[model samples]
Target chain A: SQQGEEDPQALSIQEGENATMNCSYKTSINNLQWYRQNSGRGLVHLILIRSNEREKHSGRLRVTLDTSKKSSSLLITASRAADTASYFCATDASRLWDDMRFGAGTRLTVKP
Target chain B: DTEVTQTPKHLVMGMTNKKSLKCEQHMGHRAMYWYKQKAKKPPELMFVYSYEKLSINESVPSRFSPECPNSSLLNLHLHALQPEDSALYLCASSLPGQGPSGNTIYFGEGSWLTVV
Candidate 1:
């Protein structure tokens, strides 16, 4: 079973625009992580935000966590055509220390 | 090395054929995982090995068997698979134990399997 669900299943935007993807989970989580996957390859870890943290940034990527609302969002500033890929949100539930469940994912296409 | 490597990048097998998927990581990660992903779907957890011990099975079918020969290697043996079982097999690894930090998991380029 998937613990998280991403909104806006698909999004398309022009280069230089910003892309934002949201995720909502059901249970309390110790942490939430965002990942990116190219067309036929495995996923790559993007960023991780702890439950206690509100927001974090890496390069042009920004991630925000809202534990009160059980939701998180990932924002890509100055999106480029290379940013086109599928993004997933994985949650490590507070109850389970070893298992992490991934969401359906958001497919973002950056048009050049 | 800090990467996970998987062999036989693509495989085609018959229902009665028996084959195996191999994964190796040199990062010394104590936890390894196997995940199955169908087209356009999120990868599903299949098995997990921690410290060279089987920790989680995820209720996977009997036809699939997982092996951890050492801390640096994991293998999944497949047999009697149906056509519906065709999908990408992904291997991943992360630091041992739980934490809100420094436990970022890394994945390898998945093995594309086609069952006929």
Candidate 2:
């Protein structure tokens, strides 16, 4: 079974608008990571937030995690048309190696 | 460097044909993974290799065999595949540990497989 589930399957906005995506998980996680995937391409690591940390920022990206709610949100500020891609949240619930499970993903379209 | 490279970016094979997908990483990551993704879907975990040994197998079919030749190379051998098996095969690698850095997986460009 998939560990994470994302909401608002699709979103559309202007180039300068901010885009937000939410993800809910079923189990406890040591870390939650966000990845971006272009069409017909592989995933690219975006940001990772530890369970002990509530929020993290990188460049124009902001990620928030709520362990109690078992959810996480990824916010992309000042989005660009190049930022249009599918964003997925992956949860690492295992204590051993990388046992990351990903969500269905939210497709974001930034119109120029 | 920090890239996980995969060969044969696109492939087409018949149900009876045999093929192999190769992945390599030069970052010295000990953990490697294989994932299958369908259109508009999340990538599914297929296999995981740690320290050149198979650590996790998600009950993948026998026709899909994964091999870790060393710490830097991983390969997936395919045989007698069904059309439904056609999808994007992704190769990823990361450090082996419990820390946040260890969980950050670097992915290759992926191989688009079409089983006819």
Give the best candidate by lDDT: 2
lDDT of 1 by residue, B73-113 (tens): 99999999999999999999998866756368899999999
Off by over 4 Å in 2: B100-102
Show the colliding residue pairs in model 1: none
lDDT of 2 by residue, B1-116 (tens): 88999999999999999999999999989999999999999999999998898888999999999999889899999999999999999999998775655388999999999998
What TM-score would each prediction reach against the true structure?
Answer: 0.97, 0.97
**Docking level of model 1:** medium
- The TM-score each candidate achieves on chain A is 0.98, 0.97
How far in Å is the alpha carbon of A80 misplaced in model 1?
0.2
Residues A1-112 of candidate 2 have per-residue lDDT tens digits of 4889998899999999999999999988888999999999989999988888999999999999999999999999999999999999999865754788999999999999
